[model samples]
Target: MGSLLDNSLQIISNTTGKSLFVRLWPLSTAPKGIVYIVHELGGHCLLYDVIAARFLEAGYTVASHDQYGHGLSSGTRLHTSNYQTYVADTLQCLEEVKCQYQDTDNVLLFGHGVGGLLAALLAAQNPGFVKGLILHGPIFKFLEEHASTVNVCWYLSYVLPLAYSPVNGTDPALLITDKDQRMKYARDPFIWHEGPRLSTIHAVTTAMGDLEQVEEPLSCPTLIQCGQDDQLLNKTNLTAWSKRCSKTTKLLFYEGAKHYLHMDTPECTIKVLDEMVKFCDVVRSEAASDTDDAVGSEAASDTDDAVGSEAASDTDDAVGSEAGSDTADD
Candidate 1:
């Protein structure tokens, strides 16, 4: 079993005119593919070390970058009023990984909560870059059935972009039924308690609107897994999102789980990872088969050319020998 430190690798993205924080966990055998993991809201990449390790163990090179204004990244903490900056930063990070790991057999994106929303947006925009998607508790609709509150926030953010307000009446403990996990998250220093900025909320709302209007079918394979008891999203929204997706989508609903399924029920999460890796393995095998066929065809053509040359030489020698024999006989 690899330790947490063993899987840690520093990554930086200079595409956005600034260096951003990223971490990678390379599989022991260098992995069959690469996966870009995006953390949930108010969480850092390091908090996902344990989860990343599961992917590493399953022979995947897992990498995650902290969004600007969060974690170890060099930016204004708790200051991103607009969430588009976060999405743009994530795109830069993905580009860096694609460049650095050019030989990766496959590329998959895994995201949670707001990160999942960003992942969906990226997948919607750049459909060809990612081979597949794994979304856990994606924020398709914010505040669940409480549309009134969401509308109020949306209006406020549009009018006052700089407004800040603490999310009221949310019990952190209710996020997960697992007491141990809840306590750990509560005490984790990387977990932020501050509410989102007005701009961030606006960005989220805008993203949701865009997501709702996504009518074009995605060609890539997708997996949408959510906890049955997640408070942030409802089953109706999840079902609607999955139905709108192309037929190449898989949905998993975990009973009695919470938003942070990876932390609350790791075994189930690992099972899902295994399924994703299996899908990637099949894709890689097909690609390898195609390459081998191309090489084989070229080799066969070369062999045929060589054989034809040898046959021509033999014919020439036979004709010369017959002529010489005829001359001798004459």
Candidate 2:
């Protein structure tokens, strides 16, 4: 039972018969709000300890559950039936946390990588469930770079749904620009590196397609941040999301960071974290407003004009400097 100074770790089980190891960082008084942390492919709830502590120190209660197939949870390691499975698990964990904490309706969902995809789709699918959505290096284009390989994998899913196969090997360095961070990831005993199963590839493709098809404005305020030097995803994905999402979407490309911007050193990581905290503050104010529509409209316009403009004009510079600095080490 690992615990924080003001937190406790607990186990939660859902209907799927999976027991997720969930942790909490609680506030002494009523929390400002709740933030649910959803991690990426190789990540678990515990791996987000830093962010959870940071949010706790900032007056928000934080809770996170290890995905069914990952971390301390029981399942076929690093596998899931489809995207909905992950979403269901995440939603269940949130409810359990809320119940445990006696929290109110105000909620913020934070996701990274594939977890980002799950969070965005969940908020999109369930309107008003979350007041804020934060996606760091969201997976928009999953394995499209290897379309031929993915097609073969998708076809194989019909016969070998449970069989595991490898995606192209990813460099650990791509996750963070810091040498010590990369080394820590390499040594992390809990990391899952077997890559995606066929079903997951198929689910990823389908979910991304579904996200692209939704033309309606996002129901909740969203902030999407991707490192410009990210090796896991590209700027094309950024452009697609900027265009695909509502005016409420705030987008940013960190100048010299990599895919795991949250894990990057303070110079780069703090900037993105600061932006996220600011965006959440804006949404919390909106939630407190007497008129929802007016605030939403103004916020959407400001996001569109500010983020959309910066995304276009600054990405090139961010990309341009990638060659000279240690950024390319990712």
Candidate 3:
């Protein structure tokens, strides 16, 4: 186990002037990298405690923030004016974390549910900046039931954007197979029980559409994890989205897992964490290799330049000596 340093909380304002609740878990020793956790919809940063602890033990500094309209952040619960607001808020939070921990430039993004979508967008927008992406049950396309309501929600947003309807929420049982875990999730005060507002639904759908139109493939390493038993998403969609990314994209499905793989049963949760740690290690190794390759290429280029210059100088001297000898013979 790695030694823990003092954990701290910070409040940063988003573009809309809402204060985002930021949490930093720094390691006592030099960290291998940084993992910025992005929570699912209706969930807060605290929901990532288990995963964050594991990352901390694995020598990573965990940085997270309660997004606008979630947890301790200032906004309407489970509501956002636009999907871009979430992206903007997350980008700002990441920048602040990067600024604070300038020593550790290597960073990975761990996002869950809709947060996964946000992370993917950020990684795509800023190519090569993020080393890797770990998406836990990312919601690329809504379940059949939710997709069916898209048209209705878009129409209703103008009239009833603030309406709290049952369709906007999910069954807790579908989220976790373990009864205890499901109960705990339902009971968590920080997690909003109320469904997302109609306006929020519109925002999410718009964002999903935009994601499909992203022409450039995500260049960084991406891990797309899904549960075989997840009722909220379809494996086909995840697979299709992975194809849009670079060859480094990995799609893994847990046999008996559900939506919240990180918070699933002990056996399943352990497997998820272990896989995540392994992925991070692999990404770190690849990054180191790339750096070494770059340095080697630069050195080779310099050596070639030096050798070419020396040969040119020698040839010039030989010609000058021959010319002087010829003149002396004359």
Candidate 4:
């Protein structure tokens, strides 16, 4: 955990003219890169304030926005027509970040839960948008015990899309093991305490299903963090999906931790932050190296052109001198 710091929030309009609550934690000096966070389902960007500040301290500019239908964003609470809306909104946010921090080209994505799925999809589909990804307990596939719930959501999606059904393991107490952290989540007024709308569940599950069928792996570097004891997802399935989705993916599992690894314990949270910082540093260095190599190649080409031009000038001068001498002798 990092020291508590001040941050600012603003309201930005999405492509569809929907207002989204955007926040930025900028560094006093130039940042190594920019980290854009995507919040989980039913969660707000403010929930990631601590982690964002930590990145700020590590010399990174952090930016995030509450997705449509969640937090201060304009929409029905915990609802969206489809998962693509979230992806489009997130892409808009990335564009906005680019405009905001034009100096830094290394933009890393940090996503949690459903947001992780969105980040993975974007990184896979759009390779040049981000430098790396840090996924905290992303839900690519549901556990076997939750298959029935997923089936129900899919069925209701065709008929009663707005119907509400209790989703297991959504309660703050169940997701967060620490009492203080649990209460913090429970008491957050912006959080949706009721069951998620059927359409929202359907959108997420449909996206997951699509990812499961993808044959191509993500092109960028990816780091996945999970709690070994998380009750919300199947570890085996998550591992398989990570291997399938990213050829350069790294996995880190916290022992005895639940869904919320950051809220588990101070030690665990620090370790998570450390790993994230290290990964970002490596990616930033590699990106900088690539830029340098390109510049060097261009410089070498210019030098070669200059040398060739000088040699041509010398040859022309020598030919003119020889002609003048021959004319004098004649």
* Candidate with maximal TM-score: 3
Sorted on TM-score, highest at the top, how do the candidates line up?
3, 4, 2, 1
Per-residue lDDT tens digits of candidate 3, residues 1-330? 011233378776777677889888977778899999999998999888899999999999898999888899988888776888888888888887777677877999998988998898888888878999999998877877566677788888889888875564456887887888888898899998887888888898888888888886588898888899988776788888898786578889899888999778899899989999999999999999999999999999999999999999999999999999999999
Residue-by-residue lDDT tens digits, candidate 1, 1-330: 123235355546555665567787765565677888888776788877766776677677878888876777776555565666777888777776666566774788888887888888888877777778888888877665567766777778767766664443225665665777778888877666666666677677788787778885355778888888888766677777787777478888888887887767666556655665666666566656778999999999999999999999999999999999999999
Candidate scoring better on lDDT of 3 and 4? 3
Candidate 2 — which pairs collide?
Answer: none
What lDDT does each candidate get?
A: 0.73, 0.78, 0.85, 0.83
Compose the digit string of candidate 2's lDDT tens values, residues 1-330.
Answer: 333323477776777777887778878778778899998875788888777777777778888888888888878777665778888888877877777556467799998988888888888888878899998888877545777887888889888876775664346776788888888877777777667788777887788888777785367778889888887775676576666665478788888788888789878877777777778778888787835888889999999999989998798777778765766586
| Quality of model 3 by C-alpha lDDT | 0.85
Name the top lDDT candidate: 3
TM of each candidate vs. truth:
0.79, 0.82, 0.95, 0.90
What does the lDDT read for residue 320 in candidate 4? 100
Worst 10 residues of 1 by lDDT: 1-10
- Which lDDT value does model 2 have at 75? 80
Q: lDDT at 244 for candidate 1?
A: 78
Error of 3 at 131 (Å): 1.0
State which candidate, 1 or 4, has the greater lDDT: 4
> Once superposed on the true structure, which residue ranges of model 3 sit more than 4 Å away at CA?
1-7
